[model samples]
Target: MEITHHNKTLSLNSPVVMGILNVTPDSFSDGGQFQQQAHALEHAMQMLADGATILDVGGESTRPGAVDVTQQDEIDRVVPIIKAIRERSDCWISIDTSKAAVMRAAVEAGANIINDVRALREPGALEAAATLQVPVCIMHMQGQPRTMQSAPDYENITQEVAQFLSQRIDACIDAGIVRQNIILDPGYGFGKTLSHNYQLLAQLEAFHEFGLPILAGMSRKSMIYKMLDKTPQDILGGSIACATLAAAKGAQIIRVHDVKETADALKVVAMAVRENHELGE
Candidate 1:
């Protein structure tokens, strides 16, 4: 399937890698690496060269218990980088934010997508997205990052997430966002316990019942590292494993840190799936 945004459509019939660029000081991983514009641009170029189809930029760290940064701080960190990237590359740039002001500024700075873990539920978020008319990714997080992991719960993880996403879609529609410009993410690590995270991944395809493109972001999170008794710095292998599973389950976009490995793994999966299709002919 293809995800069309800002008059551009990304054909994700095969799995695609979306490299993560965090321009903050406290993201779960790769935090300080991109705070400087020069360094951030260089790393972004490297991700593109390594075969990233999209680059997701986040100014705020959404890791549980992370303190909130002011709107101006968030804008200052992302806009310049977005402007710089847009001038140099044609790759799809998604702003990872929950704030409406950030969405408006990032789009003005040339972002093509809004990847909000809050799913645009924040005040003015829907209005801002509608006004900008860019593609939006509505992700399911159980609660605010500060307290999301406090006491997560679910009767049926898959149905609950799918239902949550469905409601968000309707909310966006109510705010005047177009169907083709929307995508859904089940929020793999935002507020989920280990079991909850794995449950969501195992039943990922159920989200397709909503008929929207699914983006999976399981890159080096606690879900994998903690389960393996490893640290985030040592989760590349886990990341690839998760990426492969997500691809096999019909995830259109994989948000990740190690772009080359993720890209190569996805290539193998995509080739196999494509070959199977051709043989069926």
Candidate 2:
């Protein structure tokens, strides 16, 4: 399968790694490291060299209990970095934000994808995404970031997530966004308990019924750290393992902080899948 957006097509024959570039000072991982234009561009280049197919640039931190950043500040934080990356490489760039204005500005700068945590539910966001004509990833967050994790209760986690994503997909389509341009993320840690997170991961393949690409962002989340009793700095192994499992289970995009490691692990998954296909043939 392939994802087409802005006259560019990315093949999903092999799971692609989306390197995380948080240009914010308070992201759960790698925060405050690349807020500078020079530092952000340098790190983005390194991720491309390490086999990241997409560079996801986020100015706001969506970590649990995070507050919102002003729209202009977010635009300022990301546009320069997006422009610098565009000037340097043709690799896919994704603007990770929920604000409509930022989405428009980022695509104007060079972003090929709109990775929204709010799934374009923010005011004017759906319209902005439809007009941008780029592939948009709609994530399923049960509650707003500030209070999502406080009390995440769901009768049936997987079904509810799937239902939420389905409704968002319909909303996007109804807003003139092309169906093929839609991508789905289960929003792994947003508003989900540890058990809820694992349940979603285990049943992630169920989302394939939607016939859209799945973007898994399980890297360095509480699901990994809490389960392993490790801190964010020490969860690389767990993160990579989740990436590999997601790839093997048919995820098309793996969003990760450790691009090189996750890319390497997906390589192994790709090889195994390829061999299996050849044998079946």
* Candidate with maximal lDDT: 2
Worst 10 residues of 1 by lDDT: 1-10
The TM-score leader among the candidates is 2
* Over 4 Å off, model 2: none
1-281, model 1: which lDDT tens digit per residue? 67666568888778889999999999887878889999999999999999998999999999988889999999999999999999999899999998999999999889999999999988899999998988899999998998999989999988989888889899888889888678899999887899999999999989888787899999999999999999898989999999999999999999999999999999999988889889999
- What's the CA error at residue 20 for candidate 2, in Å? 0.3
RMSD of each: 0.9, 0.8
Clashing pairs in 2: none
Candidate 2 C-alpha lDDT tens digits along 1-281: 77787568999889999999999999987789998888888999999999999999999999987778999999999999999999999999999999999999999999999999999999999999999899999999988998899999999999999999999998999999989889999999999999998898888889999999999999999899999998988999999988988888899999999999888899999999999999999
List pairs with backbone clashes in candidate 1. none
| TM-score of each candidate structure, all chains considered together | 0.98, 0.98
